[model samples]
Target chain A: MSDQPTGVPREEYRPSPSDIAPKLADLQVGRTVVTASIPLSRADLVRYAGASGDYNHIHWNERFAREVGLENVITHGMLTMGSVISRIAEWAVDPGAIVDYRTRFTSPVVVPDAESGAPDTPTTSLEMTASVGAVDTEAGIARLDVEVTSGGTKVLGRTQVKVRLS
Target chain B: MAVNTELQGSSYPLAQPFEVTREAIAQFARATGANSRSHFDPESAAQFGYSDVVAPPTFAVIPAQRTEALYITRPDAGIDFARVVHGSEQFTYTRPIVAGDVLAATCHVDGIREAGGHAMITTRTELTTADGDEPVATVVSTIVVRGEDA
Candidate 1:
């Protein structure tokens, strides 16, 4: 099979596990459009706290958070950040392989039911809707745009992911 | 203890230069479950345009850690050591970062807001090099404090 569409001798190709011959590694970042609401729960926060050992007061104590000026014990930064990139690990040949990645914090992620005085939400992870914001398949990279919202407010906003493909 | 609500741009007092070793990056890679030979294996790293396996793309967490020093961890932060929550963090690389690279990080207070009585603080840090001041990456972190009602 030939990659040349019009017989111009194209210079792009995807990598197979056995071959590194990609002078064809000419891949460009692609976009994966997505939509999902971030679900936050007290328990999920607790679990993540245990796993990450982030005992920051801003995270779990609703009253403490309110005392200082917070809506509730908001979710952890790493938890949400981890969620932002979790998909890449799932898709990459390596779980945590990334050539480069970054994002700017635009909003705070508030877990549902924390302030509504209702029962805790069923999940801890922010239910994020990710989409391909850009792509460079020719460079073997893709950037995913992720947004997790609830009650019409963006909980995790401006979350982006960059992945190095196999 | 009262919290400082007046912090603004350039209010962050962080020493400019720092260094990262392969060991520290390897450790972070392990904690993140992305530990690969190129990241820790010096020989394997030499194959990828890196002196060492180069840290993972998300390795910015290490420098971001230093950024924590720029903010004060206080009682009024409304954070219950027992109940604090993890909010969200984002890292953007302006240039590739590698192990054994000495870096300089400059941090700024991006924004501050009040939400349901919680003090939301956004801290931004730019990682660069001493020689050319080229930006390597940026980290924007958001922390929401849930405090007791007055």
Candidate 2:
């Protein structure tokens, strides 16, 4: 099949489901899945709020967040979860491979407002790392332990996903 | 204000069926930076074996949250809207939700507790076909409402 329809550059095409199916043998427990970083900008938050319909003032209104005792406007917890799963989908080469996912918002991700002079640059970055926590070959499921941190502080805790390798 | 423990085990009625549309899927995919073709293009989605555009996994939260509001928004629910913080989210999908599908959500309060002067409420929402018994997805959300002292 042509990769043109998927828009995935031919060179960057990670294994599709079929290809991943045959390589299940390589998915061992304790193996690293992938490590990625997603920079969070106010624009990303705005777009996410619009998309997810989570218009919580703490996520958008700086003054409201401050008044509520938060240091600054924070990123939506669900947005952080979405960003983490997008990385997993990229690694699996298919979003459908993920059947279950969960996470705990242990700490708030404080996103500073855009710089006074530079309005387009991201102010913070969330680093995510995932590892194979368990594998059930017979069930075609693999459990991934994901950690999301911002500025070296844990933001999401007990994050995990169950992916279908076959 | 003390946590409303009485609401635990309360089950709300099924919400109005929500129609999953192609535009909604595309918009969510774009916002989350999920560039998968299955979430955007119907033809490309068919190649992946889905009957229609598949929504990203987190999309289930939309319907679940809507249904959850029916319980949390009650005047006597003891929830302070201004003080609530989303603590966690978990999703287990019976199958990926696709565009053109209509779904309904039924929510039940699983538990409510107070710790360190804050209220923690856990709720579960079951998403199913609009007119059938087949399950679509289950979402579990935990919300924390801070007490005045904390």
Candidate 3:
């Protein structure tokens, strides 16, 4: 399916580190380095629940989630946080290069049931974009300011990741 | 029910050791869509200086959250699972968690306060190697408990 839920080009979905690393060496602050779209479904969340051992009802049980005031089954904040970091890790070409990562959950990404048609599709995707926020050449550390949006709403705030790249 | 503010500064001791297995790392990688070979192939992981398949960066949350629930689930803690919303998460890793390593986590309630008629609780989980007490990673998580009106 098209990744233009937000009108972004498909080429913007997977960014390679080599595409921006050269500029990073020159301390290119405020440069947009990477963009990726993470598609999620109820089955995906169920798999994440098994992998992460987070049996939170809001993440899977639709009835329970609504009972607690949530519109429907919602994705686990950690799962979203975890899944998005894969792009950063891929950019590093080495998963071990990421030394620090943090994020504040600003809003919920409601996962509609497949039965909920049209405007409220069940298969939603998160759009992640990362920019070069800071670079310390001496420490070989680069700080990235990441933005995560789902359904045109920013779901994470102050999302950042620090990488140690030699 | 409103969360009890008195639980601030409470620290929960380490529980049983958590073993990191290649299977678990691979499962997490697949679930999170992390396509890096280091998370699944032992040979590729060794090429990256890891002895075995390295876990995805956020995999630490699995064990850390399991430990944090020790206190959050206590009846007297006044934490209502139904009303809680994850607010934030941060992680600092000393090294990549590779397969075959066993870790133990200690959970500390770093901060608890009220804001906008809601309760916010911050927890820090320190992970260390089970064999030598060598530090592995530190995970900090903040959760908000919404009041009835919210």
Each model's TM-score, in the order given? 0.59, 0.92, 0.90
Order of all candidates by lDDT, from best down to worst? 3, 2, 1
What stretches of model 2 exceed 4 Å from their correct place?
A1-22
Question: Could you tell me the lDDT of residue B49 within candidate 2?
Answer: 80
The DockQ-derived docking category for candidate 3 is: acceptable
Residue-level lDDT tens digits of model 2 in A70-116:
99999998888887897787777677778999999999988887777
What are the per-residue Cα lDDT tens digits for candidate 3 across B48-115? Answer: 77899889999999889989999899898998888889999999999989999999888999999998
DockQ of 2: 0.53
lDDT of 2 by residue, B124-143 (tens): 99999987589999999999
Residue-pair clashes per prediction, in order, are 67, 0, 0
Estimate, for each residue in A67-95, the C-alpha lDDT of model 1 and write its tens digit: 75677667665655654454344344343
Q: What share of the true interface contacts does each candidate keep?
A: 0.15, 0.50, 0.67
Q: What clash count does candidate 2 reach?
A: 0
Q: State the displacement of the C-alpha of residue A19, model 1, in Å, after optimal TM-score superposition.
A: 5.6
lDDT of 1 by residue, B18-134 (tens): 677776666554433342455566665555556554656666666665666556454434334432333556676665577778787767777667677666667787787756467
The per-model DockQ list reads 0.15, 0.53, 0.46
Name the lDDT value of residue B138 in candidate 2: 93
